[model samples]
Target: MATNDKQPVDPVVRARRQRIRRKRARQSVVFGVLIAAMALAALGAVAIYNGAVSMPFARGFSSTVIPADDPIVPACLVEGKEKPIGYKKVRVRVYNASERRGLAATTAKSLEERGFTILATGNVKTGVQNAKIAYGAKGVGRAYTLAAQIPGVVLQYDARTNAQIDLTVGQGFDGLIPEDEVKLETGVPMNNLPGCQPLAELTPAPAPASAAPTEDATASS
Candidate 1:
């Protein structure tokens, strides 16, 4: 009689097979998580390229603290001539045909409050009834000279007319000419006038003295 030959089924071998299957399932879960992370990164990149998401970044078109339209007032009228005076300083030149006199002082307090300084004054003995006025700084002498050349704007004094000429410099000069006339010259240079003195250094007023202590109060103390 031939007994049926059969292979023995070991319990230890079956347990090892079950552990291997569980490890493969865990590996599959880890790989799926890695693939999901990569897809999310790609989606973010595509959204940025399509303008679906806004990235806040700095640009050159931003506004600044200082405005571009602001006006600048010069510190000194002429170089080497920065002298402070009371509000409204002007140079006055009084001329009586052949004889000329120059005086610089505070003409109008209102004008001084408005940031206007008189740099120089000249008196020419022409026969016209109205006096000629010229306004200029150290760098813009030619502009003032060109303005003086204009007819009617600069008048000659006449002896026959009993009227006196009153010429003023400052804000009035700015309005008499075009805006381009007030600019500095590029080609021809300007020569500063000689014997020019600062308004503060010319002649100053005396300062007041402090009040003296009372004799009665001193004795009581």
Candidate 2:
């Protein structure tokens, strides 16, 4: 395998070998670059998962998909199960049972401001002792929401009323329930569409006035 001059290694053969080496070097560089890029991508993803960036999770709103195993998920993100509904969607008629001539009109205006759709306002056929919300079979949940925003208003399910709901002002009527005090229940109940857990679920019967606690009594207690 050894020659005196080695035949000068053949010009064409030497050129081919040089080309092969250069090709191999280029391939190696490309492979290395690909590997580095993959590593950087993985690191960036890890950083995001570790709280390096802000997330969109917020209160009273839905969020993007979240991994069940993720520890940073917020408690507010739980499935609301509560359908999206607006107060204007609920139809109601306010009646003045308090013997106040313009009480019905005033109450109607207030309810309208709160997004309730008042079909009509008038005096009650039979004067009520306490403000009450009467609803037909179709709008119990909507009715309950309205009643919640108005303290001391008891809910009564009546199938006869053709409209969605009715509000009757009574002799003991005080005023609209404070927005902060009213807690809207958000969740799908077991009842059918126009049905809801009986009014008792949200509003318990009010304690008799005689048994009411005065500020002085409460302070003493």
Q: What are the models' TM-scores?
A: 0.26, 0.46
Candidate 1 C-alpha lDDT tens digits along 1-221: 99979888799998899999999999999999999999997997888789897656735574533212112121123454323332223332222221212211222222233434433233333343322332222222322333232223342222212111234332112223332453334343434334444333333223112112112211211
Cα-based RMSD of the predictions, in order?
Answer: 21.0, 18.2
Clashes of 1: 8
The local distance difference test score of each candidate is: 0.35, 0.59
The clash numbers for all candidates, in the given order, read 8, 0
lDDT of 2 by residue, 61-177 (tens): 545332221111111111223342468888877777655557777777888887889887766444466677766545655665676677555566553435367777765666787
Among all windows of 10 consecutive residues in model 2, the one with the lowest summed lDDT is 69-78
The pairs that clash in candidate 1 are 87-112, 88-112, 127-157, 127-158, 128-156, 128-157, 128-158, 129-158
